[model samples]
Target chain A: MSTGVKHFIAFAALAIILIALPKVFVSGSAHTMMSLMGIMIIFALSYNILLGQTGLLSFGHAVYYGLAGFCVAHAMNYIAREKIGVPLPFIPLIGAFAGLFFGALFGLISTRRAGTVFSMISLGIGELVASSALILRSFFGGEEGIPTNRTKFPPFFGYKFGPQIEVYYLIAFWCFVCIALMYALTRTPFGRMCNAVRDNPERAEFVGYSTQRVRFIAFVFSAIFAGVAGALATINFELMNSQSLGAGQSGLVLLMTYVGGVGHFIGPIIGGVIITFLQISLSDITKAWMLYFGLMFILVVMFSPGGVAGWLALHQPLLKGGRIFRLIPAYALALVPMAMLAAGLIMTIELAHRMLVDAQSDGSVMKLAGWTVDAAKAQPWMLAIGLLVCGALGLKLAWPKVREAFAAQSAEVAQ
Target chain B: MTPALSLQDVRKNFGPTEIIRGLTLDVMPRERHAIIGPNGAGKSTTFHLISGRIKPSSGSIRLNGAEITGMAPYEINRRGLSRSFQVTNIFPRLSVFENVRCGVLWSLGYRYSFWRFVDKLRDANEKAHAIVEEIGLGARRHAPAGILTYAEQRALEIGVTIAGGADVVMLDEPTAGMSKAETEQAVALIRKISEGRTLVMVEHDMSVVFGLADRISVLVYGQIIASDTPQAIRQNKAVREAYLGEEAH
Candidate 1:
């Protein structure tokens, strides 16, 4: 099939999936989860316009997301208090304009240089704004932040958006639009120039482009989309707090974009969904989830620098030739030991947390992956250590054979 | 006719060190000019100066008698002068067609536009394809530029430099690091592209310089010691003593 047809079909399938998700899941939490996915996807994709598209490494992207959230929150409040005619669905545009204003305001100085200097400026701006969010009590709402009611707006098509489903659809609609536009951007002359400037700014200039201007426009666009995301987020939670624009928020988007992979268009989407899911659900599963997230980020950077998308893209040749199945045995062999190692590590961490952190309150007894373990007991500790050693040995033994299988398939593909 | 490029007493100084000292040069339209000099004679620096990669410490540089001293590189490029680097500078991850298309975009009035799809720009795409074929990289059009052979990349570089339809093209060591066979092919490409266009080059290879340059200038210690025809440069007493004497040995 032609790529255009393929893309259309893929996009249609995604739309269908978005429409079907809430219906199939049939839960308020599921709706909330889906809404978060839409917001995170927009935020991550916007971040990629810098990290992936333009080769900008920004540490302060969350500033746009957060500031835009505040803009939306305040706009919602004014509309509600003044009894204005605006509806809730269009609120994200306020965020978009705020993002654009801030993007233009900040992009001027930051885009003057690329590399370490640009990154430092972003970091500085992030700190500056994040601090301002606290000190500027009137607009930022001080420590409590700004909160607004979505139901306060006039009904659109008789949909007051009091229901989670309605909110999901709104976020999903904006999500689809932002995602499509961002992807379409990659096909434009400006997008090509962004790539050009990213790859070699000097060459870009000689080809009749102001590389600084290209980066500045990209930064503005990125921020606009980020603002849209923040607006959607405000709609989601009915509030915009300092944490919304915090370093943690910015760091989360970076984590999502990187782990999802920064090389491909869909990388950020995958990152947003997966990381959002983990961020929401993993806490319920383990208190040590942040540590796990950190571990995963480190591994992704070191081994799969292209993120999950890169790993998937790397295996396309094998998948096309149906050689993937041949390597499955090698992979399966590694998976067993890898799981054991993961389990052992989890048990050890949980045990340590119980003994060190919660022993005074929750006691030394805990349930881990269906096993009752006492942190005070030596048998469990010995078992955890044994599993660790055995898993390590098994993985070490299995690694070369897996490499051999990969090499063999790669060679065949090359031939 | 006014010279296509005129650098009158151009001088560049880095901190306290003066480079491109009192460099006055002029190239009439459509003339093939080569600047040859020993190492550290500021050959590349001169290219950088005229191309707006760096500003000269003092002097006036004009293209087609229009003063362009200290103008931004993009502005200078828009005024119909384009250049290539001594190093292989290109958008490495982009496809070869995309690389040439980037060169063609601004000149074709598609500057900084995010609205229009590149594939939909018939003028840009066709021009890019034609240039790719002209450079004999038709088969490699879809290949990422980073993966091309060095000779192929140099060919692509020259293609990009001239793709903007610039009437004046400056090349810095375009044939640097090429094997004999590759250099011959590059010379052929250079010759074809420089036809009816002003060509300025900085080259270390004597054979390539002697073969391609209509006129040669010897730059030593940031100053041109001789500016004349190639044969005269080959025989000049002072030129030999100051520069080529060491090479002749």
Candidate 2:
């Protein structure tokens, strides 16, 4: 299918799901998921305005997101405390302009040089803003942070949004509007110049578009979207903190987008869902889930720099060339033992951490999957068997098919 | 005839070292003028100065008697003067058709189009299609320009320069790496495109120079050694000394 068609279908499906979410999922769960998706989608797409289309990687995008979020939080407080009567929908506009203002300020300096210099300046700015957030307590909420009540907003369609589900609809609506606008922006001449500047700045200059201007515009646009995401996040959480815009959360965005696929527009959406899901579900299952996630991210960076989207794109040639069914059986066959081994490893690591951290009081043990496992004990034999079987099966199933795919790719190249 | 392109006492210096030292030249209307020189003779720098890629340290350049020495490259292109680089400067990532479409966009006054889709810009698209046809790249229009053969890239470069519909067109080393057959074809294309427009090309191919140029100027050490008709340039003692040898003169 054409990429546009695929995107349309996916977007339509997502829209329908969002509209029906309150009916399906529990209100709390739906609200949380909607907020996460909304925030990440905006951030990811804004990041792509620089990274994907402009071919410029940014290390400090979180600064814009966090700053904008903080700004919106302050504005919301103003509205709540009877200091101002700033309307609810217009709050994001404040955030957007705040983002644009800071973006232009930073872009003027950062757009002068790209790559490492750009990243460093952005990093410096991120650290400065984050540290300042702590020092400036009165305007910012300081260590305690600021919280808001959404009931302050006037209701619409008989939905005052006192419930979480009502807020989810608001977030979903904003995400849809922002995504459509950003997507439409890409088809503009200004957006075309962004892509042109990425490929060849000299050519763009010769073609009469100032390369620096293009980069600056893209930077500002990305910043505005980041701000939009931040604003939505503030409304959803009803709380704003310094950590929301710090380096750690910013780094999480990089992990999400790249892990999902940076180039594909939908890649970040997939990434947001996966990471958010893991953050919720795995945090309950194991203490060392983040460690495992970190390892997976490192492996993904090293092995599939194109991200999951690139891997998906590879399936296109395979499917079109009639090698799909032939390759999948081996691929699935390789996965059976790998899953078992992963579960074993997780158990073993969690047990070891539990023993080392809190061994004195915990005397209970649980046995499952042929091993008598204590929560605070390590079974070396079980770990060793799991690793061996997993490794051997993985290598057995993966090597030949990978080789065949490469051979096919090279053959196509040769022709 | 009044000159179509003129450079007057144009001087360019990089900090302390002057690359172009008090050079003056002019191209007569509809004339095929060739500029030739040894390496580091400031030949390419002269083109850059005229194209506004670099500002002259001093002096004025006039296209059709309007001063344009210090204008930006795009502004110069808009003022009916276009130039191709010595090294092929093209959008490598764009397909051939899109590259040509970008070339046509500026001329069609669609500089910042947020409303018109590129496909819907019919006049510009048609012009680009026509340029692709003229450059004999109709078949390869869908291919990414970076993947083109060296000769094909040269052709695309010419197509791009001429696509803007400038009155005076300058091509630097237009046939640098072509075989004999390719050179002949390039010479023919150059002749075809230069009709009713002033052409100033810096060429290393003597056969192409003799076949196409109506006049020639030889430069040695940032100075014009000789400027004369092609036949006179072929026979001049100083031109031979700058090029072939004393014995040839």
Output the number of the TM-score-best candidate: 1
DockQ of each: 0.90, 0.46
Model 2 ranges off by over 4 Å = A1-11, A21-27, A83-90, A286-294, A320-323, A333-397, A405-415, B1-4, B12-18, B55-59, B63-75, B78-80, B246-249
lDDT of 1 at B110: 93
lDDT, candidate 1, B32-59, per-residue tens: 9999989999999999999999998898
Task: Assess chain B of each prediction and give its TM-score.
Answer: 0.98, 0.95
**Candidate 2 lDDT by residue in tens digits, A1-415:** 9867977997898789778876777657756776677778778878888887787777789888888888888787778787465556667787798789989998898887667777787788788888998999986688877777766865555666667676677778888878877877777666666777787776666666666777888899999999988888888888888888788887888888888787666677677777777777778766677787897799789978878887787677756766566666666755665666666666656566666665666553644346566664345546745776776677677767756755665466445
For each candidate in turn, the TM-score is: 0.98, 0.87
Output the lDDT of residue A347, model 2: 62
Off by over 4 Å in 1: none
Q: What docking grade applies to model 1?
A: high
Measured with C-alpha atoms, the lDDT of residue A120 in candidate 1 is 94
Q: Model 1: chain B TM-score vs. truth?
A: 0.98
List the lowest-lDDT window of 10 residues for candidate 1 chain B: B111-120
Task: Write model 1 residue lDDT over A87-119, tens digit each, in one string.
Answer: 889999999999999999999989999999999
